[model samples]
Target: MMRYTLNKMLLRLQNRYNYDVRYQQDLLQTDLAAFLKFMAFQSMSSHQGNLAAAPLYAARLRAIIFEDCGPCTQLVVNMALEAGVSAAMLRAIIEHDLHQLPEDIALVVQFTELVLAHQPQADLLREKIMALWGSKGLMAIGFAISSYRVYPALKYALGYGKTCSRIQLNDASLVPNRAAVVAAEAQNVE
Candidate 1:
């Protein structure tokens, strides 16, 4: 039997995922095998260059949202914003207004949602993605969406999850109801 300390586990997670994993760190405390398996899945899904960053971020955001992992959702949002995704686009995604995004990103989001929901449209969407991004790209997208599903289930089942909330990005804060904030700003300007 092997024992893993919290510090070592946190360091490993930070190195691999590049973010805090404290939200589900108890998985390490209780089931090291499950925790390592989740980490491995994440690593496998993290292959780069198969798809554009923007569309990949959009798909990942949709996946985390569908999985209902509040902390994970906020983390991805912050990461995307930091990686140069426009705040407006992130807001649109959070609101499920895919029409506001570019066609490719919108398609990726729609595909992610359908796949996460196990809807029949997922197959058709997969075909479209294959056409647009080729087989390698489609495979990467599928890996990302499916692998991201692991965290929310683990977090929720282990009593480590919460409802999504505002997240900070760079020096700015990302609120859940950004539309309301924009409306308020407009009224103030009038």
Candidate 2:
């Protein structure tokens, strides 16, 4: 059950996005001011695109998967499919097979994983991204990854997030092995 009335603007945005807004509903009910602020921030941040749609979507999906934010991951998977990212690519990401992606997109996913994990290599990955896409492009990628973090945090904090969604449940191994990835990166660094 929702805790507050849906304002006209928010309702319109929800309709347009067609996203499940259970987290937003909880936020709105608990704190209208914060909800409005978050919406405004999202609106402005969403337009700061520097990466191409496909790679950007791939990076976001990677981050969502790393976070184990099931509902959010499902939402991103849907958006990626709608935006023409191949099902094969999405499956590879879900399965943690970064090598299956094209080189550039694979790099983006790797970078996103490092960022989400707060690995030291994140700095090196940023340098690689800058070399490929320049400063603004790096910023755009960072923003894209950062933006997706908010929803999962909100959902978890509000006690609404699940460990895994139905889509992720299709394969029990869909969950990423973050520790293994980090350890491998560390070995490479050493």
Candidate 3:
């Protein structure tokens, strides 16, 4: 068995995906602000001081591993403020405790954990994935999520990311009683 360092593994992932994500060069751009915000938030949320920042990078690391991680991926999810991953998802993986997730979504959640945890006996991830889902299934599992916890939230949050406007409105009539407009019409008829 080979002991794979995180960077070494990431390099392997980069080779597979055909692009290098140079840390400072790739992740420090203005466009990646959303992702950085997400990472900083995750780090704070985890209360781990620094390790919480793990999720922020985990998402991008996933894109590096797979060819087609979504645009919202981690960066968009964070920008949109919908990156709140469900605890249930994590619990489910622990419950199933299987080598691979039968559902495509389950696989990503589990594998993402595996990658993040830097678990050894690593290649076993591919083997179990293959057993559960053939080549096509693996692609489906790697590329999708069971929840839109982030995507839709990203849309609405980003919409409100800037200026806030308020509408001044008269009180809405909840009752069936007509307004003064109705009384004026009745007087005209008389």
Residue 122 shift from truth in candidate 1, angstroms: 2.6
When 1 and 2 are scored with TM-score, the better candidate is 2
Q: Which has the better lDDT: candidate 2, or candidate 3?
A: 2
Writing each residue's lDDT as its tens digit, candidate 3 over 111-159 gives 5544434444334555765675566544443343222233334433454
Q: What is the Å distance of residue 150 in model 1 from its true position?
A: 1.1
Ranking by TM-score: 2, 1, 3
lDDT of 3 at 24: 20
The CA lDDT at 189 in model 1 is 25
lDDT of 2: 0.71
lDDT against the true structure, each candidate: 0.69, 0.71, 0.35
RMSD of each: 7.3, 3.9, 22.3
Question: Candidate 3 at residue 159, lDDT?
Answer: 45
Model 1 agreement with the true structure over 1-190: per-residue lDDT tens digits? 3445645767785775466676546666667787677667767657645787788887777787776666787778767776788887887777667569887877787777766656666677677788999998887888778877777777777777776666554455654432332233223221
Clashing pairs in 2: none
Tens digits of per-residue lDDT for model 2, 1-190 = 2333465555665676565676776678778788878878786446545677777876777767666787778777767777788877877777667678787777787788778778888787788789988988887888778878877876888888777554542343355444476556544432
TM-scores of the candidates in the order shown: 0.74, 0.80, 0.25
Ten-residue region with minimum lDDT total, candidate 3: 160-169
